[model samples]
Target: MIIQLHGRRHLLDVDLDIDIEEFTSHVLFGPSGSGKTTLLRVLAGLDPLDEGELRVDGKVWTQGSAIKVPARKRDIGLLFQDHALFPNMSVEENVAYGIPRAKRGDKRGIIQWALTQARAQGFTSRPVASLSGGEAQRIAFARALARQPRMLLLDEPLSALDTPTRESLRNDLRLLIHTSGIPTISVTHDRTEALVLADQVVVLINGTVHQIAHPSTVFEQPADAQVAAAVGVETASAGSIVRRTNGLAEVEVEGARVFAPEPSFSTNGVLVCVRAEDIALAKEQSVTSQRNQLMGVVTRISPHGSLMRVDIDAGWNIASFITRTALDELELRQGSTVVAAFKAPSVHLIPHD
Candidate 1:
């Protein structure tokens, strides 16, 4: 589906234009109050559409030319963070509520398909009030699918679940949406969700579209320092271009002359962005072919999911993500002497004023 939309919302201070083609799922990601939900709500036509032209699958839904289609006529399904299920209704009835009467002739079949696809089977007769957070969420997803929408808009649908449930259900949701053959736009603030589910990712910041690209591109090579931090490239250090040769930059950072990828601008100063995962930690000052390396003492070791985050201070602190096995092999601990090494291309240089 192809969409072109532009609008301004005064109260929210949102003014922007975005065009996207979602043959698969796209994640609209940003921090809270960053207009992620506003964009989703506008696309779903749940509220005022913020004065823009919205076209889907070659049909004009809105042109601001007296050609506005109401929400129901847009052939879209929407899910909210809260599920919005009827407290008094059973799961089946709640799912059926989203199916319009005109389409009710085969409603049972559609509801069953949705429930099965959502992994919500055997809970059709269960009361909404008695369901777990994850169970209720599956019902909500089934309700959205009951409409047989051409496009789906989800606003932080998995945010309400506990950590373990959210992670597990994320894969399920990704598989369900990909197999359903519908273009989807899901709003989220979690980068991990975007990484796992999005075929494309739109990074919105402070009511503006900051960057839009593949999850890997946006994460590995963010447009700026702010976007870098958002994608978990937690290492940002002040640096200066001592020299540029052969498209490589020699950046002097905190008394260490490190090499990194050259910047587009010929600025002398920059904020060097190094993803923790891209940086590797080793015991002692090892010799390596990597362009950037520094000898430092391990200052902290922290647990992150199944991986370990080791912080090293060689005058300047650097962080790296490695497997627990690697950490144990290296015997990494606070105050242990180590070296952090990364390739030149792994360092993203953001020019500073």
Candidate 2:
């Protein structure tokens, strides 16, 4: 195992128990104040723990013995949101700065390799101030990789770029990082980035680790209502398990019958989550393979950049996503009667109080 934290307490009682293997990539994801950054700082040796043991690759980074390794000697690379390149240096020089004097003869080759990997090969001679936002961000990553550290730490690396640049750079960065075969722990609030890059995701909430799992599993089966809400599944409604058979469970939500798969709820007052994308909108009751269906009216339409969010009133408000083309084709407007259908496997059951 590459990382282990035990008996830790800071702001909250953080008794984190996780074991990640080397060369595995994962994301520390949560809301702004969810301690994602704090956990990274702890791993980077920037924060002191009240009580815990931290081991990286079997080397004790921290423990009750008061033996804590310093950040500089940890041989970890960090890429911050802001590209903190020196204004006076060129891109190539910035990356070369991290190369030790013993390897100074190979500085040109190292810089070339880093720039090629980042797809910033042509911008090497450009002054730091002369490069575009995306170019500078790539150079920052190049500098970090120039050190060839065992682990890399990233803090919202794509948050500063524009949408187009962010998208392109996200793909390039993921390819480069995986090719390097180094264990990486990245912190990001962006769900798309987490889904695209992480093999596993660690959700932090209020100085504690809430749940850790694969990206698909985390989104499909959130550990609780709070975690579900954090990931954009926000509607919380009471329901009861009416029947269970054939790997499916019938849930009655406010007198409406909805089918879900393998629902573990045994009593009343259970909360269930259904993603907006999972809910499909239709003009009438149509024959399909989907198991859950409800009659609803279009209550509101919200435009979200490239997507349209349709709010349906089905005894309770249910949100659904539709493409602009689909919305226009359906001629969907306020007060339109629509049928909301979703697969039984997509409706997730969250623990209810």
**Ten contiguous residues minimizing lDDT sum, candidate 1:** 9-18
Clashing pairs in 1: none
Q: Can you write out model 1's per-residue Cα lDDT over 65-125, one digit (the tens) per residue? A: 3447778888788888978889988789999987977989998898899999888997777
Model 2 residue runs over 4 Å out of place are 7-13, 17-23, 63-67, 264-269
Q: Per-residue lDDT for 57-101 in model 2, tens only?
A: 678887743648988888888888888898988778899878867
Clash count, candidate 1 = 0
Estimate every model's Cα lDDT from 0 to 1.
0.81, 0.80
Q: State the weakest 10-residue window (summed lDDT) of model 2.
A: 6-15
TM-score of each: 0.88, 0.92
